[model samples]
Target: MFLGSYFVLSICYNLYLSFFRNSKYYPDPITHLVAKQSEALVDGFGYNAQILPHHAELSMKLIVNQVYLARIIEGCNAISIMILFASFVLSFFGRLKLSLLYILAGLVLIYAMNIIRIAVLAIGIYKFPQHTVFLHSIIFPLIIYGTVFLLWVAWVRIYAKKQNS
Candidate 1:
């Protein structure tokens, strides 16, 4: 029963995101601003670049080939992180008051991780442009998803145990 409702809500929220909200998935105003600022900073520092349409606002940077690289792949896109966190909570934690608190905390941690991930990737790309694709798609996703997976594991192990106790 919980799973069914969670699935429904998640689907509906995603749908709302796809349509009613900023279609680009900018995450939040802060991330968008940061992405834009980062682009400006890069250009100011003499790196030719432009901001790209991103999965989350302020989350992607487009360079010479129009390659869209995530500005903050670690999960800085707060909305996506929050949605993912909430989905995880709903799916795994069930409907509980504390679950929402956990979701909020998870989002904050995920956002911080994303900031670090993007900084690393940006440096990596500047240092080894040849490996941008590898870093952008494969490595970055693995890191962010892997971190989220760990959070989920911890949440289940700790929170579930506490609830049962």
Candidate 2:
């Protein structure tokens, strides 16, 4: 069930991304929104960040202090991660309402974490350009994936409660 649901959700998301490629949404809506929100976070951190829409590449350029730190692409928006997280939660197949609510909460947590990750990554890259590789590839990916892992563990433990009862 998890595999099937993950595949279907991934396919649907990919199709949605494909549809927006030629449309007027500007690299689709969610990616753009994520970029904007991340930019706001960076600004809150007082870095003078700017997010410019690159329609041709279908990405947002995350520029901090006039330095190109990263491109906020669709992959950076965390939808795929949410899909994976949601699939696992649903696979457990507990009470319908409980599962749906948990999925929603998990997605929100992931989204917020992604925004903070981007903000911090941009700052890390800005301040410590030498460690870009370690910061981006190693540290930030762990932040999101690690959250999913912990959430999965917590969900499973909750089910243990039900069984114990």
Candidate 3:
């Protein structure tokens, strides 16, 4: 039941986002916001970072000092990860209030971490162009997925266990 609902809701939400919420200028609002925040953070650190919208609704190029560092898309925004996280938490739901609170906190942490990850990636790519592929394909993913895994572990240990007891 949980998996079914998760898939259905996720598909519906993605479809809605693709058809209604996105535009040619910007694919996804959340992704655009992420890119903007990332650019701001990178610029704050004294780098000339800019987010240029691409033709696709969900594509934006992150340019650092006029050098293209990364292309951020909807997939990079972390919403899908949050949805997956929330789904798992809901599946193993504990006390209603506590579950809701944990989900909110987890989502916030994930979002913040994602933003930081993007900023770091932009900086890393700019400073070490040769390592761009490694940073994007490996390090950044590990950071996000590792955080999610840790969050899941914490949830199981702290909240889910309480339900069993």
Candidate 4:
């Protein structure tokens, strides 16, 4: 029952985002926000970074030191990841107050991590363009997904245990 509802709600929310959240001026709000935050992070690290919206697609190009380092799309926003995280926590259905607080904290952590990931990827691409394919396609994804997986494991072992006890 929980799984079914989670899937339904997740799919519906994604569909709605696909249709209504995108625009010619920017990617979806979440993706745009991610791109902006990533740019800020990169800049803070003493790199010149800018996020330029793609004219023909739902993506933003991350420009570092006048070179295009990455295209941040909807998938990079971390919203889908958060949805998955929330669904799993909901399925487990721990204490109401604790679960809600955990979800909120987890989402914030994920978002902050994603910004850092994007900034690192941009720097990696800028400094090592030769390895762009491997870095973007493999290592970076593993980092994000691995973090999410660890968060899930921690929740099960820590917060969820409280409910069982």
The candidate scoring highest on TM-score is 2
RMSD of each: 5.7, 1.2, 1.9, 1.9
lDDT for each candidate structure: 0.63, 0.91, 0.87, 0.85
Model 2's lDDT to the true fold? 0.91
Error of 1 at 156 (Å): 0.9
Off by over 4 Å in 1: 1-34, 37-78, 94-97
**How do all the candidates rank in terms of TM-score, highest first?**
2, 3, 4, 1
Per-residue CA lDDT of model 1 for 14-108, tens digit only, reads: 67545534534464445565566556555655566576655444245545225444454223454555566667666676457777777777877
TM-score of every model?
0.61, 0.95, 0.91, 0.90
**Candidate 3 ranges beyond 4 A from true positions:** 21-25
The pairs that clash in candidate 4 are none
Of candidates 3 and 1, the better by lDDT: 3
* lDDT rank order: 2, 3, 4, 1
What TM-score, to 2 decimals, does candidate 3 have?
A: 0.91
| Candidate with maximal lDDT | 2
lDDT of 3: 0.87
What does candidate 4's lDDT look like per residue over 51-164, in tens digits? 998777778999999998779988898887888888887787778898889889988998888998899999999999999999999988887888889889988887646866
lDDT pick, better of 2 and 3: 2
Q: Model 1 — TM-score against the truth?
A: 0.61
